[model samples]
Target: MWWDIVKVLYIATRWPWPVEMGRQRMIVQTLEFAATLGEVHLLSFGDPPTKPAPDFISSSGMLEMSGLMGIAGSMLRRPLLPLQSHLFLNGPATAAVMEAAERIRPDVIVFDMARLSHLALAIHRHYPGIRLVLDMDDRLSKRYQRMLTNETAGDLGGTFEARLPGAIRFLVPRLKKLLLRVEKSLMDRSERRAADVFDAILMVSALEADEMRTDCPGRADVVAFPPLINELPVPQQDFSRSVRFVFIGNAGYAPNAEALELLDRAAVQVSKNTGSSDTDYCFQAAGKPLAHAVYKKVEVAGFVPDLSAFLAGNAVLVAPILQGTGIKTKIIDALEHSVPVITTPVGAEGLGLTEGEHFICVLGEDDLAQACLHIIRSPEARGGLARMAAAARNKGLTSQNRTILRDRLTFAFGL
Candidate 1:
């Protein structure tokens, strides 16, 4: 603690009301930890909360700056300006943010997500002395670029099954690629700009921080904002007795939706290939409802009220996330709960947890199905994975993890 108290005015691109997704979790956790230092106020680009906010939020307001025309104009102007700038630096939002800042007049201003990076810079211009921090959470530019490339490869040589729809799909991919290219370029520029402007740039992992520096050069004061588990759930004693494997995440998001689809298809394949009926094993996915339908055997346990209890009770967590950037908070949550996880390397990135040590990492659907079967069949393997996860959580991501973030902030602001 550098001072008796330090007031922070936090701004976010989206309202993290329910705190269901990874970014929301990060924002909430960061605010909760920051409250330990001093009072925190919030301004977000969404409808204001219907009810009172948490105690940590000294005050809050909405930045309803985007309308249909503004969004379309932003898209149209993306090639001319940074996408984030056009989206967030519009007249209304900027005025609202600056006005809020003027009223709050805090020691520090924290912006959540790259969309708000421009807002942070604008705030700094008005209040030069206030320390600025940008919580990027993920390298979104890289994510969009990767997705564009993947889509191009997947759809470039497509056959016209339904001629009109197929042609439309083909054109859509190219259009998306063009748009993504603009976004990537804009995002890169914005990252560098944020690096130069903000006092600190926060990433979810060290790897992501290093990557950001490649473009940002000397000015990128990137800090790793790894998750903190306040308490690790008591490890489930037996695995053989447990019958269900669970996957937890917001399925409305594309990456998690694809993962759920993969799980569903894999479960179907496992049934046919292994001569085991759906009754042999159960896969329960708990989170937001999937955008697409899943196999009957793969149950959607939408929005589990008590995630801790659900995670503690589940035998294994199947996180077959094939695409996405940043660390999957669900995986970390599972680990903190001592639930063995099966995931791909992409899902396990930045965690530094070794394959077959903290949890099993498998490639593709077949390998995933086999891994699940192995866990179901062998309690010893499940227990072993659970023990390793518990050890890793205790060693790295416990309640004490908050100190790391607080220290980083202290250093950033010269507190």
Candidate 2:
């Protein structure tokens, strides 16, 4: 039988069974789909207490031991922990994976991220017959480099060249830039190696797929398989409350922190400008605390596990994100729950959503306030946006889309 012939192994950097963040959500969704094709085995780092999955063997103890080694390795290498993690945990993880492969004699192995591609390469090196699939969730190297640069730039207060007036400033900015470049180069090499060794590379978006093709050329087959959202029943809610805008995301992230800060200032100004003295007109912020000051006006609902129920009570979901890459899973989650979204251009990427029809897109503080005001005062407008969001969910999670993902997985693994 096809299932008998194809025993697939999935290797991930983090535990996937318990979907928490966007990456985990993608991992879980992919695993769910992959399970339907054949017998799926998962190997990941130690499971979090809050998040756990039912399938596969977990060898996370190795990762913990690797972390201890990473601290010792840091003395030799500047960023020793991260490097050691890549080397130690990945090496042992790969070894254990190979042993499993030898026992199970699986036809193929699916690596969930570029970080775990080390395992895929190891499998290819030992068992040359086994096909390997690389799941490129994001351009990790580029994303990290971008984050470092943005942080450095923010600290420098201006461009590197422009800020080099003081005696120490010249060397400081140059050193930071050089370090970032080196990090990017090293990660780029790892990514390239992973791409070259893998039989196929799967990405979450067309933009990301194009990037991988440009980087690795003909060495790997790159395809974009978007994350799927399971259709959940949304309870009817009263949209008659005073303008209460909701923003959902892990607030610990820098981009989200900045978005919440922007929303806080904008919301305060909007409330005052509109002459609305009602406290009911407020901003409800969900997720962990990023910045202390930003939590002042914003009502913090820390990490609501039951997101659908949380959305059921909220009026409109706001994603005022200014930066980040890939699709916003929060936006999709909100749309799936029939909650109207008002987001920035960056927040609404890759969803193929029409601005007004699907949700509102506001660029500036005033525009965001105005949009909130419109939605709050007009119940009909809010209802229309909610209906459009429900429609988007229907189109995104159709059976045809699931088949596309299944076919891609089958072909990639030669099942």
Candidate 3:
């Protein structure tokens, strides 16, 4: 760890106070990591938290946002900019950030995600010598491209929908594939723009870091930052009776919505394939649901407060993630909690874990039900695998990795 850190001005498109959801958590984690390097002052969009922060993490800055009309104004004025980049473009926001920058004279300005890449580029233009960074949590282009190929989408729920203007929000669910293709193309350009401009680019996956390096060689410093997990008590074990088959994720997310459907199909297959007449293994689900999707023989709990407690023993995290780009944070949660998991190669991507040794990895979607049966039938094996996975996962989170990450960030900032 460094003894000193550069004073940083961190910016985010989302208001990350009172972290409750997945994206919120990611934003907060990024802020916290930035703080580790030096004093941080945060600037973000979205309404300020109605409640006081939960005394977790914080920054002092005004909350500024672009209304629908304001965004439309930006689009008309800046015809050359991509349609999606307009979401974060605001004249008032730039003015406020410029005011803050002049006052603080920060060593580095960190922007979160490609949505803010252009904004960051503009900010860096005014202060050319200051190091600039883009903390892209996931490659949106890769995610959207996969969404198109798989044709997987659903209502992104109120939380995500609120970010869009009225017409875009209304049209998005109706025209999922078309909008995704557009977003995919625009994001591909945004990715390249960020790669070309920023002094450093932060990605959540190692493979993505290498890809970016190869695509734009010697353009910028690129490094992979592991997903930051909350420090919570390890979930208590409970391996008894019929194992609780579970799936966790925001169903508003297209990939997760598809995964829930896959879980249901696997459950149906289990009923038909099982010799017993009563193949009544009712599955449990935690997280938001789709706008309209029925869960057959599954107990759906929408957005549980205590996830670790809910994911108690006899609970197997079944993630049939057929599409998506970044590491599945939910799978990591299960591994950390010592909960057995049944997933596919896509589900287990990026996370350096062995196939059979860590978690049960199935080949095809059809093999999902059978994998669940295997985990259910062998209680001893499931427990052993979960324990081993947890051990290896924690073991990898060592000082050496931290030292390497610290060095990369430091070098990127030219410290």
Candidate 4:
């Protein structure tokens, strides 16, 4: 049978709308690709994020998201399972999945992230003939370890916080450091389990994919895929439109929150180091505002509706991420808009970007301040970095690279 004849079932932990995080963007991008190959049946948790469900989705169903109490009870009942798995896949979710599979009669089942790997396993157990594809996204275990090493694990806030029990919510801020220690172990175990079961595992980061191949129980091949980017920003010629240094990310995310703090201090350092007035050094943030995050220098722009325009007006993206894993999508967003970036080595990881060419990699607030001064004072440097980064980004996001992932998905569906 032709690849287009293959029906694909995607069990999304959440609808990839209100896309505040990179993982959510991953879900939408993967699903869009799946839709291009064939009909995609989506069974997502909670309500549809947007109205007039996307045209790529052939059909859709909403599964009830587990409440905090129910998830806690599930964790209590199933001690062996990762606590996060209760919040993701459970007995009811498995049942719902089976019912959807029966109706769709899909040949392939696809899901993203380690938390939903339990669903992949459950579906495979029930229907051994259906091939499973895991879009594992990032190496969460490594990210957790990075946070632990940097002592920023407590910043692990997410959209789910609002739903957490009052006591747990109150305690989580203080307890996150300990919970991350436990979660790192769980995520490692989950990655191994998924690697052992799934037929195809897709990772956005080539570096992480290689690491996974070395460490995990590999029954199936683990492939690294370039991040899917369908939206191309209008090309900009000018790199010195303004002196603004921007950071784009969701504050609900831990690494973003961590970066926000670093940027706040970096902004102040730049002012003091260069004796630059507000006109010479403007630090701006665009995305979900971090609550109670007192920033002495950076101005929170909240979610900018026109990111392309905003990035065009701002000359540089300063993402001094403390620690985390996975390709920084915001850097990609910045480059696409022809905006140069100044980020930590951690922020630049897995993107195959080069320092002093594609982006300026800095280590601390002092270095960040120096980089800002260098860029703002040198128009040649600003223009050169943005041009090089834009060219590099185009090469990275080429269809040739995406075709590897597309072929992998098709082969898995046929299997």
Best TM-score among the predictions, by candidate number: 4
lDDT of 3: 0.72
Residue pairs with backbone atoms closer than 3 Å in model 3 (clashes): 238-313
Q: Tens digits of per-residue lDDT for model 2 on 1-415?
A: 3636457777666665445467777887777777787677776655343644564432222232244344345326534222313333434555677677887777777776775555665677789988888887767666656557565232221212221224434454456666556555666777777667888888777677788788767667887777765567875766655546888876656667678877887788666666543334678877766545544567888778777777875467888876666778888777567777889877877667767777789996778878877766666765576577676666666622667777876776666
TM-scores for every candidate against the unseen true structure: 0.87, 0.80, 0.87, 0.91
Clashes of each: 0, 0, 1, 0
Candidate 3 local lDDT, residue 377: 64
lDDT of 3 by residue, 1-415 (tens): 2465567887877777665456666666666666667777777776676654333234456546767898789878876565667776888888888888888888888887888877777777898878888888778888777767775544432255767878778877787777677777777777887877888887777777888787756577897876643334666665544667899987877678788888888888776776652223458789877767897766788888887787875577888888877778887677656677788888878777778767788865578888866655665755575576566456435421546656656666667
Clashing pairs in 2: none
* 10 residues in a row with least lDDT, candidate 3: 51-60
Winner by lDDT between candidate 2 and candidate 1: 1
lDDT of 1 by residue, 280-318 (tens): 467888988855564656888898898777876545788
lDDT of each prediction vs. the true structure?
0.72, 0.66, 0.72, 0.76
lDDT (Cα, 0-100) at 134 in candidate 3: 83
Backbone-clash count (model 2): 0
